[model samples]
Target chain A: MKISLFATCLSDAFFPRVSEAMARLLARYGIRLTFPEGQTCCGQPAFNSGYWVEAKEAARRLIDAFRDSDYVIAPSGSCISMIHHHYPALFRDDPAELRMARELAEKSYEFSQFLVGVLGVSDVGARFPHRVTYHPSCHGSRLLGVKDEPLTLLSHVRDLDFVPLPFAEDCCGFGGTFAVKMADISAAMVTEKADHVRETEAEVLVGLDMGCLMNIGGRMRHRGQAVRVMHLAELLYEGVRMADERA
Target chain B: MSGHNPTSTLAERVRIALNNDFLRNAVRFTTERLRTNKQAAAEQIGNWEEWRERGRQIRLHTIAHLDYYLAQFAENLRRAGGYVHFASTAEEAVAITLQIMAAKQAKSVVKSKSMVSEEVHINQALEEQGIETVETDLGEYIIQLAGETPSHIIIPAIHKNKAQVAELFSEVAGEPLPADTAVLAAFARSKLRGKFLEADIGMTGCNFAIAESGSIVLFSNEGNARMVSTVPRTQITMMGMERILPSWEDLEVMATLLPRSATGQKLTVYMSAINGPRRTADGDGPDELHVIIIDNGRSRQLGDPEFQEVLNCIRCGACLNACPVYRHIGGHAYGWVYSGPIGAVLTPVLNEEKEKWAEVANASTLCGACYEACPVKIPLHDMLVYIRRRNVEEGRTKRTERLGMKTYKVAVSSHRFYQLALKLGRIGQKPLVRDGQIPTRLGPLKGWNNVRTAPALAERSFRESWQALERELQQEMAEMSPQVKARLEELAGKRGDRHEQ
Candidate 1:
């Protein structure tokens, strides 16, 4: 089975460590991940901004990139959500691309989803002693219904003190272009999210999507706070490394 | 109403709202309390999803056959001694209302909480003709006293605090009334009772119009709707054309959903259905009832695939409480009669100049929280995108924003260009990058940097490192275990996705 990586553009350009961590962690189970070079983006930025014509142009390339893979996984739930939730409608005009879009949607999965649902591996023999809180990005949890898979994975991690984020489901306001277009409103939203994360008083803030994590983490940094922000994949991988070093 | 575009642009309005700490905290506290109560109420009545779907189906069926149900409702209402008028425009609705007021020679009209009346600017119209119009509902009365429109569908004065309410009431009381809830309620109750007795007409907004029974239904916590409908000699009901339910049975679903979603009550304190004008034998009720069904751009949405489901909204304000944008800015920032997720969609769709209301749609993050919270399952998040698409198709978006998206299209069209763009981004950030992060408050980063640090591109992108990672992984590669492989194959055979909303 050819398992491919759809390194969402944000993960590809800004947080490459997320994909690297995902690749290393999945490799522990003998799953060799394939990187399809043709993929660039899921076209959510254009799609959300009402430029479906351009969004389709961006999406067609991505759908074709993973056409041959048996399964495609991404570290960010938002990107996978864009593929599975919007791609079919994005390509609705062309029947051929629509079929490929549907095919791509079926094979694609967010990282923890691919881990727990497909591999049936909730516990990856990882240990993290730090207190952490998770921010469920709105797109990932609401659009994709990826509510439990991440929680299940976190629950299985040894010695990981996880405090649930207050108002965990509220948007961090990193809505693709929304952060720029409606910046003030977006700032207010992220400010509230940062306040909640602070309320948790956790050492690290973990979330599924880089978009949300970046927004909240950026706000935390601006406020001169030292709360480490990480992708769930990166957190789990670091936990594995911590356990390995102890061993 | 307060949403009458007082501040001009949405950005300026949002700026003002964000700076108002008291308004933000008040909205946040109330919405949080309401949201928690709604969740508890919905959970206490198990299978909330089933109820939502049922309410959605009934609304869908009724709307799909709107013309048929509306005709039946009109005829039945006429037979039950109620006059029925259909208005296609806001002007027409107001004209019909004014004509009725003229016929009744109404000097004063007492009103319940009627969003439709607000939409028509009826109070201003009535006042222009030298007739008195008073809001009888507590929140509506408070906002009316402040010379503002309702900021919320259910909680009209959601943005106002008790002190503000006291201020509004003290002016009417001609004394220094304390900013106490009990004192304020007593003041309003006594003050409104006099108007209700002296008014020549009663006015109301219908929650649901039952087609089979020719009845108008109202759900209110204060019982003010009952007084509004029963007090005056003549009664006027203003209903949106889409507020029809096929029968009383369908209203049962709505009755269960509306109050719970609005304020987390299983049932409103007062639920009334007026079959028609008071029967000849009836001792107390409006002697003459007039039903004015107002279209006001609603008929345009009847067949529109993208926006039709928006009508499924029961005006519960659940979406408002769920919306993060609304939580920060409150209702007035929407700059129209409706606010929150529903307002974002409705303002653009229900107005003639779509371009003018375009920015209202951008206020949301397209977070889909509203859809999740909607009791009738209206897909507001998707509808917002469609509204934005309409704006884009008509050349309503900013030229620079359009150009930016077009440039983005070119960059992401192929992986090579996308890589080249990232390479450019990395090099472009060298001067701005401070210890691996771009904290500069310059250029496009101004708004973003004002609130948070912008991340600079990584030293090496994932794809740039993929080749080396693959070589390292090749040496460690092993065969997948049998059980996992079988699970993968089994998963590959299925087609339906749980993500399909």
Candidate 2:
């Protein structure tokens, strides 16, 4: 019943409301939550940029910080994927650290995966009236196999109309540092993604990962569109707040 | 329009590709068609994953014992009255090709679609020697007239639209031709048929070389490969050393995967397997056949752990169709004979010039679509990471980016430093923040803000709000009914048990 939050660095600094929403939603489900202050970035930027040694430094720090938690969950799919899939590979040379990394990976879960898979709660008795579309982040949908969990949960939300995003599985081009390193290609990909979002004609775009939302939402803002972007956690929390007010 | 000049920086070539709306539309249309076909074909072939795994295993086994299989292939080929020549480098391959051409007194040579010939610059080399070399494949012939290398592997003239093709073919025909597919095809067929009949040597690239039978296989939709291998009195097949299959049974797996992945066909129009030169009783076959096995830079990857699996590639170009970057920039921006995700990894690795081709590697988003699309399951995305790592280690990365990454590494490893940096960033963006986004192209945001705005930093860090949220959560949990709490706890316990198991 106890969960430790792994608020990714992006969420921690730029999208704090996502973590706040996650906390509120988990509490409504009668779950106990703790924040591990020592938690930092998941080393994805370094790891993805081919800086293995630097990534290992951050990985070891994360592993040590969450070494005692029974369940460590992150709001971001990409960071969780880095821990669950990449950590063991990072520590392959050292058996002790490798074992610890594997153990940590086993216990870590992406936020939506934790909600639908672990908690077995699809509808939290909440209502959302706006038309919404979902963008499945590449790491979450493909890498972590968190494909249907988010969609299934959204489908169960009371009064929420879910429109399927066209080319939903394609990446939003927030490839960590790739957004800057190959900005031109990244812009093109995000442009196409924004076009897809417009085609859906959804009022709000929801995704589990903040990195993707930031890129897509930023593009939407740049084009001066009125489409609102919300993290899945924020939407779920909004539902909980609405239900609580009615009660 | 020979392929984009290799000397131009990738950025320059990308600029060119971006500006050419026609090229972008052509590449996108062709790749989208190919991708849709491949998806449909994959669905038609049930248990696609199993088929892919089988293909990967076959390629892996062959590449693992490449030496033994290649030797067996050479022996079997020689036994079939074929001459085998080994070329360790591109220059050596060109030299061997020219030597055979001279020995046969070959004046006009016809070539089927061959990437290796492109790699070796064989057309230029042969033309330099006053030998007429005609590309027989329709796409190749179009690009050949354009004086450009292939942009896509399967569709070599992928960047050319029907109008462009008509223009290219018209120039070769000495008359204006309509922008009709049928007209272009007819023109190419008539012109190539003459060249195929008059040419003394026919040069083709091997798709898969059956080791046991010592037969080289060619898969083509246009049937040009058959002509290149049959009509000419002398035949030459250029093969990468890694293109080996242990037996015909293994070829079945490749046969299933290659066509489906390349163009989503159940089979290429022609899948020709030639054992050797024409036997005395054989009809409509070359009198003399020569097989050239070129290592070039492939041998450098034989024992390499990170890259050995790259040799397993079937060159299906599924990765190209699946890549977003390639879809935008086309193949020319790769600034090499090969382009797309495979080209991003292969161009640097094959050339062994990591520094020169580092920009090509950087061009990718590392999205792993290429890995997903690969029939042989080559970890091209991972190899790209390794390539980027090599670039960084070799100091091929930009100095500013290197310093930035170093600073990022330092800042992100600790929560305290990460928090401090965010606080600073929030304050530093006061002048830049407009309507909740940073829209100015300044400093590090120049490239990004040019096309898209970046989100302004949050006023409050999550860490600052967690304490209050945790307090509220504790109160809410305490107020929950006992029965509801027990049920949730029990459900959580069961889920945990299942996960542990």
Clashes of each: 4, 5
Each prediction's DockQ against the real complex: 0.84, 0.58
Native-referenced TM-scores of chain A, all candidate models: 0.98, 0.98
Over the stretch A49-141, how does candidate 1's per-residue lDDT look in tens digits? 899999988898898888789899998888898888888777777888888888888888999989988899989888999999999988889
Query: Where's the lowest-lDDT run of ten residues in candidate 2 chain B?
Result: B478-487
> Chain B, TM-score, each prediction?
0.97, 0.96
Candidates' TM-scores? 0.98, 0.96
Model 1 chain A: worst 10 consecutive residues (lDDT sum): A88-97
Q: Quality of candidate 2's docking, in CAPRI categories?
A: medium
Local accuracy of candidate 2 as per-residue lDDT tens digits, B1-501: 546697888878888888899999999899999989999999999899999999999988999999999999999999999999999999999999999988988899999988988998899999999999999888888888888889998899999999999887778788999999888898889877888889999999999999999999999988989988989999999999999999999999899999999999999889999988999889888988999999989999998998999999999999999998899899989998889989998899999667778878877767778988999899888788888777777778788877877887778677788778887888899988887778989888887887788888888888988888787777767355676566656755665686578
RMSD of each: 1.9, 2.3
DockQ of 2: 0.58
Q: Compared with the real two-chain complex, what DockQ does model 1 have?
A: 0.84
lDDT for each candidate structure: 0.91, 0.87
Q: Estimate, for each residue in B24-109, the C-alpha lDDT of model 1 and write its tens digit.
A: 98999999999999999999999999999999999999999999999999999999999999999999999999999999988999
Off by over 4 Å in 2: B478-501
